[model samples]
Target: MPIPDDLHIQEAATLERKAFAAMESGHLAFRQGKISAMELFLLADKWELAEEALRCLEKTAQSS
Candidate 1:
């Protein structure tokens, strides 16, 4: 079984949006001193991973 292209694209877009939202929340938390620098760095890593995942999805779709 395989994921349909439309669904895959939608999933990728949703993940990317959530990743951006998480990054924004992390920034706000850091600015307000609610979170530490290390925590913010972790959130940044998450966003980077999301970006990489999106790129992989796009590449896979292109090949398909």
Candidate 2:
């Protein structure tokens, strides 16, 4: 039942990545004034994708 390292996300990795990307996008949306501060304040608490989302944000900020 062990999935090979190459087969990672054979279960939920795909969903996790998509979730992380989506949540990170929320931050950008808020930063660009697309979403209100109060909106992020409220929805941020509901986001469970912190670490990965931050990682994505860091990369994006670095690239720009």
Q: Per-residue lDDT for 1-64 in model 1, tens only?
A: 8777887788789989999999999999999999999999999999999999998987777666
Q: Against the true structure, what is every candidate's RMSD?
A: 1.1, 9.7
Residue 9 Cα positional deviation in candidate 1, in Å, after optimal superposition: 0.8
Query: How many angstroms is residue 28 displaced in model 2 relative to the true structure, after the best TM-score fit?
Result: 0.6
Clashes of 2: 0
Q: How many steric clashes between backbone atoms does each model show?
A: 0, 0
- Please report how far candidate 2 places residue 9 from its true position, in Å: 4.2
Candidate 1 stretches with Cα past 4 Å from truth are none
Q: 1-64, model 2: which lDDT tens digit per residue?
A: 6445433333245546666677788899998999998887756665665445545655544454
> Which window of 10 residues has the lowest lDDT sum in candidate 1?
55-64
Model 1 collision count: 0
